[model samples]
Target: MPETPPRARALETDTIRRLPKVLLHDHLDGGVRPGTVLELSHEQGYAALPAEDVDALSAWFAQAADSGSLARYLETFAHTVGVTQTAAALTRVARECVLDLAADGVVYAEVRYAPEQHLEGGLSLDEVVRAVNQGLREGEEEMTALAGPDRGQAAPAGPIRVRAILTAMRHAARSREIAELAVRHREAEVCGFDIAGAEDGFPPTRHLAAFEFLRQENSHFTIHAGEAFGLPSIWEAVQLCGAERLGHGIRIVDDITVDGRPVTDDLASAIARSRTEPEAFALGPLAGYVRDRRIALEMCPSSNVQTGAAPSIEKHAITLLTQLMFRVTLNTDNRLMSATSMSREAQLLVDRAGWTWTDLRRVTVNAMKSAFLPFDERLRIIEDVLKPAYDD
Candidate 1:
């Protein structure tokens, strides 16, 4: 594997690998290191793994994810989920994920995990949240110490500052309860709430009570929408449920059209124009609403392809969406399952999507801008952390 250089400025294929990124949709359990899986599974005596060696186990996971079957792709998580039943395992995995993102040039990240899933080993939800928070604090402190006092003139800042988002599985029946749980920990590591699961059969409307509660309490939340599903899911999440962001919102492509054909080409062209003009096309009702409302899209390329949300990398809506200034953000969604890093995700867009240094900086900044933090803190991160680093 090639190494990213220190203090990269321009967005070359290699530069994208070193440029700072902000991720908002990565899953904690889904991003566990394969070696950690092997170690934890061995310790717990989980009977689900086919490979004992770490390298072989990672290879197996990659193969399974590439199999184009969501069920088979999900089976890779059996070991990760099995091992993550205890507080110690959850904390270690969470810490390692932050370290991994930092090494991959992710300057900021929000890792989401369902607390209910980790409580199977006899810990309470609050205990699981605390354990994860402890890991995040450790990772941030370590990374900050290693960052030093800025490398004089060349480099501007450090690697990553991570937060946790508590996710409610869509198939589960604890939406309101999870919503309350997320709100209870806003000042802690819990930054926001999310609902994630199979998007086709389950929609955000199913969690109306949860969304309503969050809305009433002024709590932030993003909904998994329009990934494996279509416009209906996006509609429910944004129009009906009031989602702050749309996770893997690739299916917003359904509402766009080009030359009388229901496709993303002209939309892509329109997006390409917006990079320079910003007033190239008239937005349809759906596009207009999403754009006007500034609903961020947590787009993940590899995960999109793996989950059958996108046919190919080049055809992904990230290109068009960013060009159109849709407040697009690059994300991992699942680092382990996708066999990807934040750097690799940005590198792919630069390689296949024709993104430039300005493009990389702007997209990353877009992500930071849409983060579910207080205005002052978000501004501090952007002006103090992101701007100085990339402006060079």
Candidate 2:
């Protein structure tokens, strides 16, 4: 028999679903509704999907993502990214992404996708941004309309306020161009920049010029690191490139040790049971720096498990890190692939890690603080919306 994890102030499933959320690391291309994917595929004449039926297709996505087959998991994206080449498809998907998050109780979100990936249909980068931005704006409007007329501009503050993060593929050479595009459209739905792909061989420093340009322009960016790779990936993202927030910075946990053993739940209990810190909970240089600096870790448990960054949701390092008070925030890296949402992510943590409402609030605030929004506005929402809703 296993010992049950202790809880503090956990909320019920319904209550957790009602809590407001802030999403900082979500992919636009990866979150399309399964039915929408099928519709777009049929409309666009891309017939490569494994299943035409939405339910079967949705199940296929879940199984591939959960089956430990990285190649099969990635093939799901080929279908999604394949159908989203047209501007109309991009706009619809972007709009639906916003609406879905809003309906899921996300008050703020930064959805990211590679503009380069949508150019197969001859749409320029600017046009890609334009279509996505238009969809986002329209989505905001439709969601607002769905809410009662009493909420005016306050609607966005409650329903959802979305911003687009322009992503550049890591294995490609167009990072500098994408960085420029991100900066050029900063005033639009575009809010920041990122580079994401396999982190094994392609270190973030490969796009140093792009990062340098963002620095020169005084912009914000995040790098995908420490997911499939290790500390070296995170080190370069933070120390080398100045990433404001780490996308899946889970491997930072690798730096912590206690009595020569890593800090898992079992090993950590030994240190805690001993009631001594002389050799207990030692933070390696990287983990110490990250914990001290409060760099937010975008811990996508389901996606991490899919990619082998973690073994299972219950044994995820996020549980250990959260207990140790690292800046752990939950995100649904790809909803369609992971069959997850912000609410589901929180509820899973509640179940697997014995997280309380307080823990949920802390991570929500963590993501809000690390959001690309201006600090004052971020603080405003934390004060006006999130804190009060949690109190209720």
Candidate 3:
């Protein structure tokens, strides 16, 4: 819970953009390549595309996903989902996703997807998981080979590492099954469980049995909460369901007040006390708990603006969230939909938030610290990968 000092250099001016980063909340179905979507959709004879050409199709996705409603924003996934039903399609997309993140300078990433959605091609959950894993491994190998001798010597590591998080749709009744699947495939490819979908009515508490099962097995899980709803959803994600982290916990601001606007004190003792007391916040219990626990927020600024979570880039809460010492990590919630990259996300934070290099380093390290992986592994990424990259 210690707050780092801010620096004068902007995020783009910072050395950390070249520094390795860890991504924990990205979605596979949401990160597909538009060109791949065109080819795969054609191969499968799926006809839901807004445009046939790859370039036009890519623009079409961006335009369609720009709708403010989260539901309508999510509708673009049907085109992506339709193309990804087959194992070959899934592998290709997964591989390209890894390559894309690597190109964006991510040292480690965990991409989540619901296996049930990909079963439309008659493939079982395990098969889909293996195919995606194979794709990741293949992509990492290719990246390593392409790193070249000079860049390899300059870069202090092998190719980027990726893990898969098996997501179960919130509206579906298969949470327990998916939780078991995640635990069952822990060594193979699966690293954790997540419940992704609309967050308004389909709260995390609906999957108590699954969360309980995961807790019993000592498995890691992050809940998609507070993106489209208010503090109630975030409260349940943590208090009722025991989520280790909240994906896009943007709505926690609804509880705070800063200069008559929403902003929690960066270092308030009362807010800090809520880490364990759970009910100590005079402003909002949810905000206090999140702040005290040091729970990381996987914030995707561009996607938030596109979905109307915020009105614009400059006015986004992420700027204030970082300043408040919240454990905030920049992420690409849906790369295809937002037409974004992790580097682009960082650059946008710099351009709009006036974040310094130190700010970028601090947030990236916060992400490494908050990763669902074990502590030692996360530390290794921070000390071995991130530190060297930024220091150089």
Question: Which wins on TM-score, candidate 2 or candidate 3?
Answer: 2
How much is 326 displaced in model 2, in angstroms?
Answer: 1.9
Clashing pairs in 1: none
Worst 10 residues of 1 by lDDT: 150-159
Q: What TM value does model 1 have? A: 0.91
Clashing pairs in 3: 258-261
State the lDDT of candidate 2 residue by residue for 169-206, as single tens digits: 99899999999999999999688999998677899999
Q: On residues 160-251, what C-alpha lDDT tens digit does candidate 1 reach at each position? A: 77888888989899989989999898888688899988777888899999999998989889999888788889999999999989998887
Could you give me the TM-score of model 3 versus the true structure?
Answer: 0.89
Candidate 3 local distance difference test against the native: 0.81
Q: Which ten-residue region of model 3 has the weakest summed lDDT?
A: 266-275
- Per-residue lDDT of candidate 3, residues 131-222 (tens digit): 88889889988888877566743443457888889999999999999999999989865789999898888989999999999999999999
Q: Could you tell which candidate, 1 or 2, scores higher by lDDT?
A: 2
Q: Point to the candidate with the largest lDDT.
A: 2
* Candidate 2 wrongly placed segments (more than 4 Å): 1-10, 69-72, 149-157, 264-279
What lDDT would candidate 1 get against the real structure? 0.81
